[model samples]
Target: MFERLISYLDSVRARDPAPRSRWEILLYPGVLALGLHRVAHWLFEARLYFLARFVNHFSRALTAIDIHPGATIGKNFFIDHGFTVIGETAQIGDNVTIYQCVTLGGSNPTNGKGGKRHPTLMDNVIIGSGAQIIGPIVVGERARVGANAVVTEDVPAGATMIGLKARSTLVPAEDWLREFIPYGTPCDDPPCDEQGSPRRDCIEKLEAEITSMREEMALMKAMLAECAAPPTPVRIRKSAAKE
Candidate 1:
């Protein structure tokens, strides 16, 4: 238990940019909620439902973040700014980072008796602030859900999901965040290339298409000219009708 505490504190210090003493982990609402959640989860698993609920309530009070004890969360998980939510059936994998106002919630609230209701976040996944990952969707490993994005479908691994309905994909080279971010990981498109200029691939493709279209137009003009021209008089050698 002490080792787990140390690890949780270490994660908070390493992941957050807030300058603080090591002992100050005690006051961190996200860290505090995680500490209480450990006990609450144990109690819940032990079938002590009331006690678990009580502990969960206390944790929520301490930190505005509300996580059901029934949710299965792994190690090195960090939640920033609290007020984030994890539903009962939500399963969070190791090293997942969630920002404030994020929700791993159920899309269908009416039927809650059986099966997985919430989203499953895979390892190294990051959820931006205010992003709502609803339903039983699976967010693949290393995927980033952009802030304020409403996601109901499964996200592919290493994908950057952004906007309301655009769902455009950035290149793998641009989407991968190998290092830790001070705050929550960003899910938006990366800046211009290393040279600070826009990528040339799209422009090159457009130019190639324009060239092809010009060639097609030239061929069409040649065909039209041929069709409009006077027919050449056939110099058919007149043979004396049947020698």
Candidate 2:
């Protein structure tokens, strides 16, 4: 398509940093990516695996993107900036947004068996920049993978993953995108406070407090019981009689 060529040219100009003529400013990276991905995707689907790989390699050399031919990427799949990498056998769902330096690679160390090695991402997932999701895991629909997270397990639907090893943040689907999408507006949701909620530190502190309180209450109860007991009476009657 002529539009695709024009878009690619514009992307080249945009990356150049030099001020281009008025004609180049109209180019859009998203549109250009969509167009190129279509051709590359077609070559992939046609079973021209080698050709598809070549196309992706060439594209990456020029654009810094490396989408494997075996990977199934859906429409409106935006790969922002360069240095984006999607691994072979990674199944990407529709309308997914991926940023630069993201990897959807496999972790099959042995490479003994031949099954689905890469991750299977559900629809509407937004992977933040620099995120690394490895293994044959299923990332559920509408889930958001935060930046620099290293996920190796299944992610439930509508969950938000953050941090090293990627724990679930339990964000709502509506807030997930708003919260974790890189370069977007910072989220105003409840902060993951260190001393609040069910975080590890908070849980440990609460447990310690409960243990201390229990010990204190037990000690107080023992003291009160000892004080409340009637004192043993001496032989007062006998002593009075004797007197």
Candidate 3:
């Protein structure tokens, strides 16, 4: 346990290197708060409700991050630039990166009890800054939740979800990585025809040509099949008057 603690401390130090000047690297109270919250979260899970609440209150007082003790967070979870709020029932998977101002809260409209109230985030999900993922939805693995996106439904695996209700584009990760723009940009060009023309008339002409070619090919194949078939024997009954 000591070795693991030391190792985690080392990793945190590496990520947040001590600044040359003391004032430059102010040790965020949120870090210690996270540590205590982890312990409190464990206690809550272990059915030590009173103790867990005590620790939770202490941690919140110190860091101002309002994470409910019932929330299930996985390993190596880092919450940067605090003031982040997670609901009581939020389920976060492993290696999920959440930035500042991200909210994973309950969207249950009814004041009714006993139902899933928070979002379920899958593994390796990267949520950009200020993203608001709400409701009882499952965000799939390796999905990128764009900044300030209001996702209300289940996001598919390896998808990039964006927009008001989060419309997903089936763009591969490699293509997304190649782009320099951080946020998504809309295309301005008008739709093109099948034959690479701006005019609809050209598209219609091409479609007609393709349809005609298909019909001609079908007719030719039927003729070839008929020719390849064995010839039927002709009945050679002698002409009635010839005999």
User: Model 2 over residues 1-243: C-alpha lDDT tens digits?
Assistant: 667555545544433354365354334444354556667778888988778777776766667777776678764465667677777788888667776788899876585885788999898787877889998999998788877888999999987777788887776556555523442212443643321324546668899999999999999999999999999987668768988
For model 2, state the Cα shift of residue 71 in Å: 0.7
Q: List candidate 2 segments past 4 Å from native.
A: 1-34, 109-111, 173-188, 191-243
Q: Tens digit of lDDT per residue, candidate 3, span 11-52?
A: 344444453543332355545666787898899989999999
TM-score of each: 0.72, 0.63, 0.62
Considering only N, C-alpha and C atoms within 3 Å, which residue pairs clash in candidate 1?
A: none
What is the lDDT of every predicted structure here? 0.79, 0.70, 0.70
- Of 1 and 3, the candidate ahead on TM-score is 1
- Compared with the true structure, model 2 gives a TM-score of 0.63
How large is the C-alpha RMSD of every model relative to the true structure?
A: 10.3, 8.9, 15.2
Model 1 CA deviation exceeding 4 Å by range? 109-112, 166-168, 173-177, 181-243
The global Cα lDDT (0 to 1) of model 1 is 0.79
Error of 3 at 16 (Å): 6.9
What is the model-wide C-alpha lDDT for candidate 2?
A: 0.70
Worst 10 residues of 1 by lDDT: 187-196
lDDT of 1 at 167: 60
